[model samples]
Target: MDKFIETINWCSLRDIGFVGPRFTWLYRKSDGSQIRERLDGALVTSDWLNRFPSAKLFHLSSSASDHSPLSLRLVPKPRSRMAGKLFRFESMWLKEPRCAEIVQEAWGEGLREASSDVLGKCLESGDRNTRFFHAKASARYSKNLISGLMDAREVWQEEDSKVEEIVVDYYQTLFTSSNPSDFVELLQAVNPR
Candidate 1:
């Protein structure tokens, strides 16, 4: 065991670029001689460390397994034209008198007796009310916009082009006013250069 530890320590010093918190792992055995030794290790090339400025290895406490898990947090490289933040609706918007009325009216009859045009109008008004409500609600919640954008970007990447286009169009409709110039300007303002 001593020889093994020495070999690992030497190899780690030579190969692992970043020497983090010395203690890496713990050990427990049913045997009378309970030994706690660093069982888990992390090794990264110098170039990899340089590439990921925020990268770090964390030795977590052992739960069920004898070996502790090593967590790596890497700072993603900057990208051009990141996704715009999603518009989050606030709960308070439901408290607004007009928004409350629109929601109540739209869902009142449950769209059973209404004609196609009536249903369409109700949906449009309901959508507008919901959007307004959420905007006000989001202000209070103070949700992280960057994280939301990152998640949306991931989804967009996995989707087909047509699906991605539809999502973009939907967001445009939800976030921008009816004015074309205003919409374009708003999009440019949110998108990265």
Candidate 2:
């Protein structure tokens, strides 16, 4: 149909970074008219295209459905495997009497006056350290909380009100007493300003 063709053309021109199979939708009527049109589409901004030059769109055929599937692919973003390993602190730093002092010392050392490049590196290191510490702390707290709940499984099995009360109190303590100072250094590292 004229409308379908116009729509495809309009989308193709308006959209940037389009690649792979062009057609999006295929239609066939019992009357024997086969119409294949690009009903589905994707558009990546110019900025994204420049940042991820190899990004591409993939079009797949539909075996059971009338519409074809569209997919986007790009190189996987890099991430640090050790970035959020939070449990380490539970065993290593949680009970250490000087843990707070150590953290403060590290914070001070990381942010001491330095060149722009050195400052940037220090900030990144601080951010990673903070993230790792917090993640571990949170995970430890959560695990303990879950264990406590599991211990009350028998009570909860008999009554829901008691379980709800325990849960409510746990959350109240968690939210109100949770300390952000533990990760302040990491936050400053990510945003020195």
Candidate 3:
């Protein structure tokens, strides 16, 4: 195992990494004792990593076999723009060295091709600029603006009109047309009978 790691490191290969079951290998002895450990993973060349930055390795359930099955799924293209699903990026990930490497590799080709490209640029720009990402992630502008129009259920059409109606009623109560007699009385406040 040591030799294998050494060889992979010497060759500049990187682990694609995986998620799911921590223990890939499980063994149960006749004495009623069981052992488990992560025994399966994939290592890849830099080129492969660059091509599939969002690629994920998921572990399948292990039943008859003690070793869990691993599968690789490529990151699909971003969804349609009109879907209203804006991308949210977390700046906390920038604190990790591996994250920077991933972002750098994702944009190493000198092209901002993927949605992740904006994130990589934000990280490279420095910590002070992280607010942009924070705002994007929070989406406060859109949310607050929509709040006055759309309610908690997100029913834009019906709720927006209801909100406008309520606002109109509120202002009308505050600034309703006043009687001219009230103004005439105020103008003659100092007059004697």
The lDDT of each candidate is 0.49, 0.52, 0.63
Top candidate (lDDT): 3
Sorted on TM-score, highest at the top, how do the candidates line up?
3, 2, 1
Error of 2 at 6 (Å): 15
lDDT of 2: 0.52
Q: Which ranges in model 2 have alpha carbons more than 4 Å from their true place?
A: 1-14, 17-20, 76-193
User: Against the true structure, what is each candidate's TM-score?
Assistant: 0.28, 0.31, 0.41
Task: Provide the global lDDT of candidate 1 against the true structure.
Answer: 0.49
Query: Clashing residue pairs, candidate 1?
Result: 89-134, 90-134, 90-137
TM-score winner between candidates 1 and 2: 2
All candidates: CA RMSD (Å):
23.9, 23.4, 20.4
Better of 1 and 2 by lDDT: 2
| Lowest-sum lDDT 10-residue window in model 1 | 142-151
Model 1 TM: 0.28
Per-structure clash totals for the candidates: 3, 1, 0
Model 1 lDDT per residue over 45-109, tens place: 43454455445455665568766667775755343345664433345444444665555565786
10 residues in a row with least lDDT, candidate 3: 142-151
